[model samples]
Target chain A: MSSKNLIIVPIFNEAWNLPLLFERLGALKKSWDVLYINDGSSDSSKELLEAQGSNFIDLAYNIGIGGCVQTGLKYAFEHEYDYAVQLDGDGQHPIEALSELLEEVNSNECDIAIGSRFKRDKKHPVGRTRRLGIRILSSTIKVLTGQTILDPTSGYRLFNRKSISLLSENYPQDYPEPESVVFLLKNGLRICEVPVRMNSREGGISSIHRDGIFYMAKVMLSMIMVVLRPKESSHGSR
Target chain B: MEADNLVDINRVQYIAIAVSVVYLLAILYLIRGKKIREEYSLIWLLFGVVFIVLSIWREGLDWISNLLGVAYPPTAIFLIFFMAIFLIMIQFSLIISRLSRNNSKLAQDQALIKQKLEQVEKKLSEK
Candidate 1:
């Protein structure tokens, strides 16, 4: 409440889990401002958000998850919030681990704090093939950036002002998690992770499951492109 | 025997010339109706002109084939057509990428503006 922290929740068609996600968010210890950026949900999500009177922005059309999250970061950047945290609307990221992430950013420990589900323990609720896919992405990041990110695919993350400003202007479009990690690291931003227990998706199908093989291939290619991109001379220049 | 082959080649050229004329007319009609932007129509117009020239000048095709070291003049025509198609495809991809980027940026800005408008309305009503 005291700190200028904004929690960004990017929602698509998670109508079934919106109530529970809101409840968990309301139960958090610190009353940080929450911003929900809806990615053109065709379901009852817009009505629910309106009825609840929660602060949210319903996009005109679906722009994918990357654009949804970047909108929140843009809001944070415009409002001059000190830190911005990203949480999934599927109820995967634990609310309890938020404090640790904020603490790390608050103490200047790192520019970004990622809530990793497979830090010390390699156990995850996803299928073996999907787990292997994440492992491949992690290894790719390590090889490319020289930084071993235990869980590069984790969407639960906290970004400071520097990262918020940088990402708001430019973020990946499709399957952005791993590629954005490489993007941030390449720009001289430090990223560390805190182990957090994640809940299996409460509602809606996983995005990666529908196109498992294709998703892996695209994300891998995107990471390589990120590495090949020239560093921006100015951080937030258009 | 050589005279017979010449007649057959001229027949093929006549058919090609007819097709080229029709293609060029179609492109012009589309441009006149504003169905296709002038900028994009330029390439199609260029294609039509090239096709007509190649069809009218029978010796031009053979000359190009000889210049390119191609065994057959028909093969040379196909090669040029494919190269043009490749260039057009790349141009289309570039246009689509720029359009999608602008589309997403517009969507994001619209959402933000709507939110701000709502807040302003709420404040005005409270006052």
Candidate 2:
């Protein structure tokens, strides 16, 4: 087991999937430690994260995906882990992709590796509208940061120490995925992607509300605003 | 206008003004905090002062209300009260949102501290 290998999972009200998520994660037991940071969920997700008996950090409140992931990254950085992989609790992310990410991190000097389901299988289940939305954001991220990313919205990613340090300090508060990609690239970190298959959500409803389509427009506009804004350095006094 | 009732109304107006002045002083005392609670109180205080002035200036009150097309003084007062209440409710919602955040955070912190203590105790026992 490598000393610095880590997988950080952020959980929020995904109690139904926690048991299976933990089982699959435990089966992989390839010397990687799992850290689940439970967002302020009213459900038993907190109890499940605690019961799973893995290392975790409990957030103060519902800080959304951006803040939850940031909390996990901060823990990883403070504890000096070499790499951190973020897997979703909703069971859509593939655990097998962990290998591909590790390979990239080890063989290549890549700072971050993302799992691109759409590019991988060409059968990703995202609706047409969503595909369009994601593309606009992906291309926008590319233009803003001069970095090409296939899946800017992927929650499944592996970050090395440098990437982790960069994100832990400066993360977007709103629709964080596309905005975060820009942030990473603007800070001079290279991002690469590996194809990984993802399944539809196994349990619990998607957090995207009935007005989620509307949310995409809002996210798109906000991402544009974020890209337009200037970024401060990681070492700069925040 | 009945003479006795006019005297009673005048007395009530004076008392109301006095109360409003005291409220204004109290709001000034704690405006530094400027929190939701204080803001709510400030709204009430301002309304009190406004109501006091309107009550004393009967013709002026009627003129403003009539200009606004509200016939009844109580109706105008009710309308303002409802609007102020709406603003206060919004403030209440904000406070609830903050309270929920504090509750979740304080509980998580407590749990973390307790978990660390248990880990310490387990290590001591193992040693």
Candidate 3:
């Protein structure tokens, strides 16, 4: 149950960041194993992932962020890892603050720790649509779960055994962040967000930016449906 | 079965026509998607149409009912049930066929991959 066991980073069409991310990860490679969940990146991503020669999982196609994250958690759960963290392939997440997050999980500071940009300790992208949309989603999640999460859409998070087991069993299929917050809380898991610096994208346009204003509304609504739907009654191996 | 015996069989025709008509319309509405394009939904849809027409044509149903030595509405109702089961069986067959095709393709790919890997190993050993 030590913290420096394993971490999974989900990447999609993020070829530019891979080399730097891998270098950053190489520093943490001694005690931690990194598993990259490749989400059907039609770039040199698959080639790099294959050539990089590290532990990785390849999804059938581009199932988006939710699917990419879940695939990593599923691997961690099946392989019986002590801990798992979601490192965004986009390089927005600050990997320098990784030790702090790991320490929090290891000491039972929190069963799961999320990296928050809203706490003012970290720099965030200056986009009105993203800010406003995440704000709406956070408020709705608070109402649903009675817990006001500071950054419900943050991709950076560290999860212990309980957190990974639950997510791997039945994680959200779409727009998962807010829904996972409610899901973990409802099941009595301790969750909190720590302020962490989030950089702008290194290269290439994100899918969210491609859709722009229209995507903001669609994603916000999608998150609500995904988070608030009654959990399925069926148990054991979906 | 006990509930059926409690009801007067003479009033069956009046209720049967009403129930059959409603189900027929529902089946038709579901088939609206099929009308736009050739859909797998057509199989159930075409059968539903047949059941609707047969049930409504009272004389044709009555003659068949008389020949079968059963009450008219009950005959039509049972026939509709049978048609539904038949469609489900057809869908099941379609799924089975698709799976078999995928299974064969996967096996072939795996065999080809294994052969290539073995060739690579042979070359490495020679080097």
* Cα lDDT tens digits for candidate 2, B1-127: 5776657657767876777778677676666566435645767677767776776777876787787799886687677778888987897899887775556445445545555576688789999
Query: For residues A37-56, what per-residue lDDT tens digits would candidate 3 score against the true structure?
Result: 77768888878987987666
Could you give the fnat of all candidates in order? 0.85, 0.08, 0.00
Question: Which candidate tops lDDT?
Answer: 1
Residue B40 in model 1: shift from native, Å? 1.8
For A1-238, candidate 2 gives per-residue lDDT tens digits of 5658788887888888888988899898667888787887889988877776777777766777776777677767777998998998889888988888888877887899988867767767777766776777778776766677878878889999988888877666556777777777776788888888877878654433444676677667766776676766544346
Local distance difference test values of all predictions, in order: 0.90, 0.75, 0.71
Q: Which numbered prediction scores highest in TM-score against the true structure? A: 1
Q: List model 3 lDDT by residue over B69-91, tens digit each.
A: 77754666587578788877987
TM per prediction: 0.94, 0.70, 0.64
Model 2: what is its DockQ? 0.13
Alpha-carbon shift of residue A148 in model 1 (angstroms): 0.7
Residue pairs whose backbone atoms clash in candidate 2:
none
Worst 10 residues of 3 chain B by lDDT: B104-113
**Candidate 1 structure, TM-score to reference:** 0.94
